[model samples]
Each structure stands twice: as structure tokens, then as C-alpha cells.
Target: MADELVFSVEGPTATAARQISLAEAGFTERAHLQEWIIQNPQVLGEGVLIVTFEFDRWRNATGTAERDRLDVLGIDRNGTLVVAELKRGAAPDTVEMQAIKYAAMASRFSVQLLAEAHSSYLSRSGASVSADQALELLRTHTGYTVDNATFRRPRIVLVAESYPPIVTATAVWLGEMGVPVNLVRVQAYELVGTAEPTRLVSVSQLYPVPEVESFMVGPRSRGDSEQDVGPELPEIEWSESDYAKLRALPPKPTVQAILDLCSASPDTAIGLRVIEAAAGRTVFGARGELAGLTMLVKGRFKRRNWPFSVEWGATNGVNQAHYRMSAEQAERWISSAGNLEESPTSRLRSQEINDFGSPVSPAPHKESGVTPQ
Candidate 1:
């Protein structure tokens, strides 16, 4: 067995209490350690997003009797595939090479393939989730868009009790050469007590040091080749008549309450005051103390009762609440606004609205402010 980790108890006088050996604790078995990691992937460290453990089996390209299985597969925040190879005892000399082969095969995996694998893993674990749902969950958690560009390359991670010097040197060289590879050492310890379970684990990253690790795993290293795409500006201008209609529409208490909250801060409210940029356009814009902190509200009213729709734009430096709702609903809620409940409409984001931009049948009358009889 390797050097065993010991636990000491300290009181008036300190004394060595219990010592844990991976071999004696049965953690030296690959299956046992694998199971523990599958249960608690966070032990791998922060920013490690494990999508599935014991990922689907893959046959060797040579078509022989040989086959290979990846112990764990995941993606970091930047969407680079992470192939984690685990060992219970000493890491084999061929572990890094085996991981490279796995990474090569996994690099071909498209976002759809990853989502399907994740869905299957979820099903096996008794948690129900569709491939689309799994993909959305992955995006929500990692903040990385799942697409071809994002999943083009892969990184490698080796986890074991100890790694040979050769493997450590190779990992460092690969990392410096722009290949994102890391080594993590995980050791098991035992606690002296009458408790039902008396084992503890410690995980530490050991290769490439800490300073270089960040740069190697950062966004630039994820192989993202495309430039950042900004939000598309609206082509149609707001008419002056449109602004008048919006101003005449009755205010909903729900919206007014939000306005009131903004009003409480005079400086902020003044900075965010409504701007009438174009005829028939009324935009309530405000900037918070924080840079890029902004709120914008745009509405288009019809001659009928309420405005046709009101768009409560993104708020709080986050694009969470971009939604459009019918004028009548706003009026009804505002007139009798009480305890507010989350409406399904409020969950709409900008993408959902953009999806509704397809051409539609034209109304009978083309004249402005004209209603069909």
C-alpha cells in the first residue's frame, strides 16, 4: 500500500487516534472509488461539471475484441469536453495516453450526442429528463451555449492516489502547449469513532500548479473561434401615435409598484427617466449605480382600451425578464393588484419573442387607427 493518511485527536494532550490505508479500507478497488466520485463529483473540485459517470461504452477503432469506457465525462463553463480518468491506486504509465485516445473519440461528440447520453444517464439514475431538457440544464448550469463550436475540443483530467513523475511532467508540458490537461490526487482517510461510517476523503490538484491552471481552463482555451455577437437592433421605428397610445393606457399596479421602487432612489430614477426617442415611442430607461445595470420598458398601445402589448425589458444586469403581455391583462391586474403571483407570461425571455417574428396574415384595414367593423 502507499503512504497511509492518519487522523489525530487533540485535547489536553494530543494523541494519534486512527490511520487509514486505502487498501485496508477497500477504497483501493477501482469500482468503490468510482462509485464515490459518481455520487459526489464536486469532490473533483469547483468548476468541474460532470454530466455523466461511466459514460457510454466505446469500441476500439481497430474493430478487434478490445473496447474502452470513459470513467467520467463532462464540460467546463466554456464547453470544452472534460474526460476524467480515475485510478484507485498508483496511476498507470499508460493512463495519460488512454485518456488522450478517449478525448479524441469524445471530441467528435456533438451537442445532441452529449444531450442524449445525459438523458440516458438520468434515466438510469431514476431521474426523468429529456435530451432537450438535459441540454438546457447543462447550459443553465455552465453558462456555455451547447453547439458545434463549443464542443469541438476536449480536455483531460487524471485522478488517482498518486501519479508517476512521467505523467506529471507530460501533463505540465501538454498544458503549457495549449492542451488542457490536469492531475488530481484523491486520498481516503479513516476516523476513529463508533460512528456507522468512519471514512474521509481529501482531493487536491497537483499538476501544472495553480497559477497556470486558470489560464489553461479559461474561455480562450476552450477553442471558441467566433466573435461575440451583440443584440440585434430593431429595424422598425416607434411612431409618435404609438407613444401617445402607450401614455394613455391605464397603468397596472404591479408595474407601478416596480416604478415606485425605482422612484424611491431619486438619482437612479432621474437617470432612468422615460425617453421619447421617436414619434409614438415612449421608452422608460434607467441606469443603476453599477455599470451595465439598466432597465428599459417599451410599449405600443392601440386605440381600444389598454396598449397592445408592454415589453418589460431585461433588468438587474441580467436578461431574465424580457416579456410582452396583452394590454387588457395588465389593466385587470393593475386595477385589483394584490399579492402578486408569478404568471407564466413573466418567464418569457427575449429569444422566445424573437421566435414569433415570422410573417403573419395582414389585417383587413391598412389605415392607421382604423378598426375592422
Candidate 2:
């Protein structure tokens, strides 16, 4: 009776089970995926892709005191430092924090990595650059020489199949604090094969936080909450003195006004190409420098954080302008101007223009006294 019960029972899934085992052992290994990510960053995330160097290579090349077990250490075009942490299973809660730390480190001393990247770029291009030549090129290309102090803030990105609940919560909290964090998901599939030769299919996709928020909010929010909230309207307020100061200045609206205008018109060229605010004066080039009219905006503009805007066309030349103002002020500006104009205070006295046009210096209004944020 015992020998008769020892007969084996096999199902169709038995062979597939064996393939799954092999795939888990071979394809799911972290090191293999890590190497793949380094070679093909498109398989992980988007933006400027890069990778961390080998321990000895990084140490000998940069003398950096870092030992990050991540995929890359670099910066994106928007000055966002990339701290990419990859995972085989899921994105852990601590991955976000670890990536933040790496970002902070990169922000402070990114030149070390930039140097290596530049060297690699030159090597790939089959061009040789001397120390002096590299320095000159960096300055010419990047607008300023590489410095460690003015370090831009870094952003954290997690690469995994799915982010743990804790990671999602932490990222949302950080976003509220103005810290940029993102998640990238990599999906793996079992391609058609038997136990003899198996194939693992994989694809990576990025999910920005905004997209996540939209998903979580669902279609219901699309009709109600979204319309209720509307676009994030900017606001600005100016005191009587601020108004008087602006009025006293030449017809030049403050640099803030120019910025405010430019912010409104991303497609136009009337915005502040170069500017400074605070002391109530701004110099910006518009209407084409060849047109020989560099509009100088100047005056005390409240709420420096509000984005400025502008409009440009053949009929209006540089066209109408706009700045963030109170709802009431916005209505007032719209009502009074009849034509397109800026907000906060629509009526401008020529005296305000003189104030911004004529500096408190002997030299030709060389510098705007407003300090940068």
C-alpha cells in the first residue's frame, strides 16, 4: 500500500514552476540588473542618465569620501542633483532618505563628478583637453566656473517595481517642504520559453509625483476639486509708499514688474533676460537687442516670489504685461487699462519711470541694488 501511494502527480504548471525558479535566481539577481541599468539607463529612469563609478575608480579619480551603493551620482539639466537608488524587489522607505543624503552631497561638491564626466565626454569625442583648456571651456559653456559653494539642491529618485507605502508618504511630505522626489517603476515579465531557455522581459517607466496625485484623486476630483481649486493664482500687494516710489520712478516699471510680465508670457521675449529687484530698479533686454530698446524696469514691487509675465506681437510690439495681484486689483487693472497692461496698480505716472531710469549713482545705472534670493 505504501509503494502504491508513492506515485508522483504532475501538473502543467510544473515545468513553468521550474522556469520561474531559474528566473528568480538568475534574472532577479541585483548585480545583473545593476550592470544593465548602468549600460542602459533608459531601462531605469529618464532625464540625464549617469552611473556611479567603481570603488577603486571613484576613489582614485576624485578622492571622494563617498561609498554609496546606488546606480548613479550626477546632476540633471535643471540643476536637480540625481541620487538614484535601485532595488530588485521594491523601493524601501529608507531609499528616499538615502537618496536625499546623496543629493545633498552632490549639491555641495558636484564639480568632482562633473570633472570626471567632462573627461569621459572628451574621451568619447576623441578630443584632448588640457587643464587650462578645460577650465576655459567650462566657463564658456556653463556661464560660470565650477564652484562647490553655490551648490544646487539635489532630488531623490527611487527605481523599483513598486514603492513601499512608507516611501510614498515620505515623498509627499518632502514635496510639501519643496524637496523634489520621484519614483520610477521597472516591470519584468516572463517571455515565452520552456525550462531549456527562458527570457525575462523588462521595461522601466517614470511616475512623477503629480501623476501619482492625479491617480490617487481619481476621476471624481477631476470634476469637483480641480475646478474648485482652479490654477494656482499668484498674488502681490504694494503699499502706498511702494506705489509712490514706483510712481516717482521713470516710466520704467520695477524689475519685478518686468519679471511679472515675462512670467505671464513664456512664449514671448519681453521677460527679464537679466534683472535685479529690491532697490526698485531692473534692466532687461527685449524687442530684440538689435532694436536698440532695452526696457529698464525699476521700483519697489511687493512679494518678490510672484512670477512676472509679458506679451509680444507685431501690433503691440512687446504687447501687454501682467503681474500677480489681488483679485480686486486684477479686476481693476483689467477694467481701467482698456488695452493690455500690468496689475497691482494699472495707472502709472511718468515720475515712476524717472525714478527707475535715473539711478542714485554717477555712473549710468550700472547695478540694480536688489539682492538675490
Candidate number with greatest lDDT: 1
Q: Where is model 2 poorest over a 10-residue stretch in terms of lDDT?
A: 364-373
Task: Report how far off residue 202 is in candidate 2 (Å).
Answer: 3.4
Report lDDT per candidate.
0.52, 0.42
For residues 91-170, what per-residue lDDT tens digits would candidate 2 score against the true structure? 66787877775565455444444554545545554676433334223322322223443346666767776677888888
lDDT of 1 at 18: 58
Query: Residues 309-352, candidate 1, lDDT per residue (tens digit)?
Result: 22223233222222132343344343333355543333333232
Query: Given candidate 1, what's the lDDT at residue 262?
Result: 25
Q: After aligning candidate 2 to the native by TM-score, how far in Å is the CA of 92 from where it should be? A: 3.1
RMSD of candidates 1 onward, in order: 16.9, 14.5
Off by more than 4 A, model 2 = 1-25, 28-31, 43-46, 51-66, 110-113, 117-151, 193-198, 204-206, 209-373
